[model samples]
Target: MQKESVIKVEHITKTFGLTKALTDVSLEIGYGEIRGLIGENGSGKSTLASMIVGTGHPDSGEMWYRGEKHNPKNMLESKEKKINILIQENGTINGLTVAENMFLGKESTFSKSGNVNKRRLIEEGSKALARIGAGHINAADRIEKLSFEDRKLVEVAVAMYNEPEVLFVDETTTALSQKGRELIYKLMDEMREAGKTIVFISHDMAELERMCDSISVLRDGHFVGTLQKEEITQDTLKRMMIGRELTGDYYRGDYEMSYQEEVVLEVDNVTWGETVQDISFQLHKGEILGLGGLTECGMHELCKIIFGAIKPDSGSVHLTDGTKITSPSSAIKSKIAYMPKDRDLESLFLATSIKDNIVMASMDKIKKGFFIPPRAEKELADEHAGKLEVKMQNTSQYVRELSGGNKQKVVVAKWMANGSEILLMDCPTRGIDIGVKAAIYRLMEQLKKEGKSIIMVSEEMPELLGMSDRIIVMKDGKQTGEFERSEVLSEHDLIHAML
Candidate 1:
């Protein structure tokens, strides 16, 4: 039997100002196949996908759809042909109702003689929601009332409502719960059965292996290779993505450092609504305590409470010497630093220079008398930037220009430079590449050696198992299980505890 190509991208090259984003990239996605696009940050994976959707233009190359050359001038043109892209970030309007956002452009279709048919619009939106297994969401409810995971579901519903023949989902699963992810996977299966093609990008290797029919890898703006299902393994994929033989587990480390007997931080009888109840945990000096659970398990909210971003309904945080830190400002004053899950939202000043962003955390260190010293600031920024191996032409460059992985490194550099004793990290390696992740693990170890304590919240099981001195699994808003480093916890064990 002859296979039909749904998307054929040939000799694509894209340049942005002075940077070559993609070079001579060629790929063929067959009809009904879910193609996994795997690559490190800045490796041209997103660039190629953008070119396909017409969000970007290839400097030189052609894309063919159904035996005809297709050059879509914009996303609207691509959408007209039933090609849709779900970006990594949420694109919903928080102030609008779910139904209004879903049928945004085609609202005129729901009008009869210039009168809007509200009932019909809600009915159609409800049907779309049911198809995506998100029927629980009210069509008329404002998007701001929804959780992050539910908002992600709404975005998926919007894409599915268009009935796209070719779908591009880029890092959309990171925000979803296990059930939500299952719904997405089921929808992908149905779409494939209906002869649709999908280009799926994810940082989770397990999901990619389970869902993708074939996988193509890119490295440093060039296509490395493509492999079929049988040829794809975690190690093989890592090697291809990094262009080297990767040794040891990405999370491999022996955290032999012991913490001080004195407690560095303690949460006692914490209660935050019904989601979190009577939660208590203690972190020691120089120790890494990991929190793991499903998206709605309250781990994220708990971190926010401790960091003073959210005021706890009850409970108190006491420091090592029995001193209390009440708010985020006090936490900062007391030498505690927090890195939130969404780097784009909570960390990094996109419009600011890399040097300024890094120095923002250590303004006290750079200030001499009543004025800030430029030389001292540059020296501090350059020192940490070199240590973190942030790739940039100059520290004066804005953080927005750096790749995702490098930008994350800058976040770490900022906190480390500030001499923070206790660090609270939430999904520190969310969207970065394997190489950068390994570097982060190494940095964590270095912090431990420097007698710094860390409380980390992460969704990646392997990372939790690899780097923690102890693991705490939360369910709803309470602690369900605790594991010592020697417990050798399996993925299944953690998943069971989480659910």
Candidate 2:
């Protein structure tokens, strides 16, 4: 039986400059339910969510909430009207404590005689954190001092604490560990039981199938259709989103692969503060090594250390020829490429043009006596953009305006154009759709064929199982088990090792 409708969006048409994000899109979300929103990058999932959450208003559309006109000017107003959203990005202020951030824009209850009561604030934040299974984190600690995953937990706790009528979750689980994810899953179930509405946005199809009561698909800024819980399946959802049947194995199909015996890079006795402890690993030529563990297992930080972005306190990373990498510049100069987790800040200059971004890493190769000809740069950028099949208006378009998948493509194409042989990637397919994930896997296969090695750190178990030749599990700064990827290997095994 269908639940009562809580939100009715009618013929929404939204445009950003020349980009039509949504065209005549319409859907209904009901009370006491979880609805999944999915599509390829640039398919207008985030835009629609933003409209519903008051981040942005649709250029043309009318919405009704509980049979009343729903028009909100800002997020604060939306929150006042019993609506909340857990945005994809870290929405907390770096300088503020968790307690302060949790109560931001609504500190009146804690204000006593025009002065905020810090003690009561911390007490409330602690309860919130504990409710979300994050009791280890202190609410009084500054946001900047927390780990990225922990900060994400704080965001989830704050967003769920309000008991809003409607909640929006956007690409939040990609960075989270399994434990963190379980907490969210629990809250989602609790919210549904309490008759609250949730609009979930994610690129993970399996997660969507498991969590969503109904799934809505969009393609090219147009509404395709919605699927009931019983109708949601892998191929069916893919067909709906892509407008056709998708062919080819999602990951590399080859199991009996050959790798070079020569080790291309080595990490010896690596120790960094309390995060990494006596860690060591070796990467061979043409090998795809997978790292699997909880978000706090130190693999993410280890990637930075391997790439020389962060130096270990007492150890070394050495290349095949015994070249020590102490910094990112040295690693880059030595033909090593690192794709960081935070793509917007660490990987690309968002304000720069696509042409400039593509050629930025390969500037040393394109310079003509201290000057790179614009024509030459454009040709190079266009060649790689074509090679990666990056969707764009032109090479001169700003990269920030592109969707998440395209931005990732730009990052990869830029590094590939640098002619690097070693790739260090952290959550390379974190929030991108399946099509883009397949493309990245294909690219990795091509790179492996060309004798390049990759050390991939990711949280998605299916991806690691599908793509890696070998998987290493870490737990609390220690290696617990290592296994060769085979038909018998299962997520249960990985989870057992990880926990």
Candidate 3:
């Protein structure tokens, strides 16, 4: 028997200038149920969610909340209706305290006599953090001081603090670690038990299969279908999402540790503060060295150290030719590229055009004397962006308008345009759909075949196992285990080292 619908949309149509975002879409989400939203990048999943949360509006549609006509002008109105959302990108304001971000636009609650009670605000923020199993975070600290993972948790606390009747999680787990993901899972389970609703959006098919009561798919602004929990599988979900049969292994096929013996780059006893301690590693020609660990295990800091974004206090990073890498400019000059874990903040200039961002790192190659010829820059950007299959209306489109997966593609395209011989990819496929993930993996394999070295740092165990020629596991700022590619290697082996 079908449960009563808590939320419903009919004949929803939305457009952004010349692009049609959604068309004639309709769906129903039941109370006390987890509904999964799956689609390729630009398939209108986020668009639909944005409309429901009042961050956007439909060109023509009717929405009902518990059988009432629901048309909210803004998120504040939706909040009054007890509906909330955890957005995909970073939502917290910089230069603001955790408590301030948690209670943004609602500070009047803590005000008396035209003055705010800062102490009360922090105390309430602490309670909110504790409710989501994240009491370790200091509510008084600045939001910028927290790591990307912790900041994401703060967004979760913000979304849940009001105890909404409906919660929308859009591509949130991609930024989280195992512990953080477990916390979200526990929270969703608790909400369901309490008769609340969850609308989960993720590109990870396995995650949806495990967490969702039913799965819905969208393709090119149209609703494809929905599958009950019993009918959900990785293959079926992929088919519905991409509108085709996806064959063969999504990752590399062989277990062979293939690479050359020539050392391309070396990290010699690198130590950085309390997070990274006496870590050393070598990148060989045509190698994928995987770095894995828990959220606080310092793997991310190590990537920055190797890329010269953060200088090591007691050690050095050098190329095979004895060139010291001590800054980003030097690293880029040395033919080294870094795709940071935080793509929007570290790796991309979101406010710029796609063509400009793609050609930013290759200025030398695209310039003519003292001027950058527009034709040369456009050609360079167009070639690489096309190679990556980045879905954009044109190279002139602003990168900030593109979807998350497509934004990641722009980041990769920039490095490829630079002809960088050694790549430092930290969570290269983070927040990307299956189709884009496959493209990236294929690109990595091709780079390897061309003798370009890569160091892949990821929190996803399956990615490390599937893509790395050698895996290095870290715990508490130290290397705990190392494994070579083999068919017998399992996630358990990696988890044991991480724990």
Number of the predicted model whose lDDT against the real structure is largest: 3
Total clashing residue pairs per candidate?
A: 0, 0, 0
Residue-level lDDT of model 3, residues 472-492, one tens digit each, is 999998999999999999999
Off by over 4 Å in 2: 1-3, 107-109, 112-114, 368-378, 485-496
Query: Which ten contiguous residues of candidate 3 have the minimum total lDDT?
Result: 1-10
Ranking the candidates on lDDT from highest down gives: 3, 2, 1
TM-score of candidate 1 to 2 decimals:
0.92
Better by lDDT, candidate 2 or 1: 2
CA-RMSD of model 1:
2.5
lDDT of 1 by residue, 1-499 (tens): 1249888888999887677888898878899999999898878887888888888889999998877788999989999899999876668887788888888888899999998798888888889998888999998888889877788888899899889999998888876777988998998999999999999988688899999999999998998888999998989998899878987566645644366776889998888997777889899988999999988789998888888888878887778677776788888888989998877668889899999989898888779788999999999999999999997877898897777788899999899889899999999888787889889998888898788999999988888888888889999888999887864467888888987
Which candidate achieves the best TM-score against the true structure? 3
Clashing pairs in 1: none
C-alpha root-mean-square deviation, each candidate: 2.5, 2.6, 1.8
Q: In model 3, how large is the Cα lDDT of residue 420?
A: 96
Question: What is the TM-score of each predicted model, taking all chains together?
Answer: 0.92, 0.92, 0.96
Global lDDT of each candidate: 0.86, 0.88, 0.92
